[model samples]
Target: MNENAESLSRRLIRNFNTAPTTHDVREPLYDSIGARLAPGTAAQKLGASIDTVAPGKMSCPYHFHYAQEEMFIILEGSGTLRVAGEMLPLRSGDVVFIPPGPEYPHQIVNTSDQPLKYLSVSTREQPEVCEYPDSGKFLAMASAGGERVFDVVQRRSNDLDYWDGEP
Candidate 1:
């Protein structure tokens, strides 16, 4: 460890509610404040974050990963979980597990009048592919040494044959 690195005890402990947040907003209904909790910790195979979504907003789109699995524990307020085309009610103390693949495309919408908060944890798998079923889009990402190497999102209609343009 570096001389200035945080001690083991400090690194292992994190407070989701008080952690600094990053705003993630995209037009109409996608808006949330996220506090990442795994970057400087000793954890090497998992990632975690605290996400807060305002009423009537969604933190992210309906998508599923090909290599990583995720779980969310609702910490505050209520919402609606849109999973596999079904809307399930979500409230504080609810724990939701989402497996990777096309069958479990999911998203959370804050339908209540108060802000919804949740702790999200997922496997840190590299070179992962995620599909957005609602928009017919997909994302391929690869990272090296904690840095992104390649990232691209495209529609399925843009795919080409394996031998296309090959000599």
Candidate 2:
């Protein structure tokens, strides 16, 4: 088998029961799995992943993106969506759209006793920044406007002003 056989080859998954890579997130108590399905495919601009959150767990903190956008399709079980300070019920077959912006901060909370499964798709936008509302933090990755040389920076949400470091 070639080293890149699977990634470069086309295939079908009769069961979307899991992802190509699966891992346990103990701090949050959830299972995460995903495949860079399009990295070697024609759709290099898009990416997909499947996540299963244990009961009473969350996929991530309420956050919003500055460049990329995401869409999620609930595959099974039930959960709640925390969107811009609002809690919305989520269930199987529900589709969620999260566009880039500070107003679109969102998170998925497993509100049911069973595991919550969902398929998430997002754009591969570079030089992105993510804002975490609850933690008052900002995660930024600047690659000089998409250059391969990336600089990751994280700062508190209430940190200094834009001109704080200016001469």
**Candidate 1: tens digits of C-alpha lDDT, residues 18-71:** 788899989898889999998777778899999999889999999999999999
Which 10 residues in a row give candidate 1 its minimum summed lDDT?
A: 1-10
- Local error of candidate 1 at residue 14 (angstroms): 2.5
Q: What local distance difference test score does each model get? A: 0.92, 0.76
lDDT of 2: 0.76
Between which residue pairs do clashes occur in model 2? none
- Across residues 81-150, which tens digit of lDDT does each residue of candidate 2 receive? 9998899999999999999998889999898999888888899788788888877778777543324466
Stretches of candidate 2 off by over 4 Å are 1-18, 26-36, 142-153, 157-167
TM-scores for the candidates: 0.92, 0.76
lDDT of candidate model 1 versus the reference: 0.92
Clashes of each: 0, 0
Residue-level error in angstroms, candidate 2, position 131 = 0.8
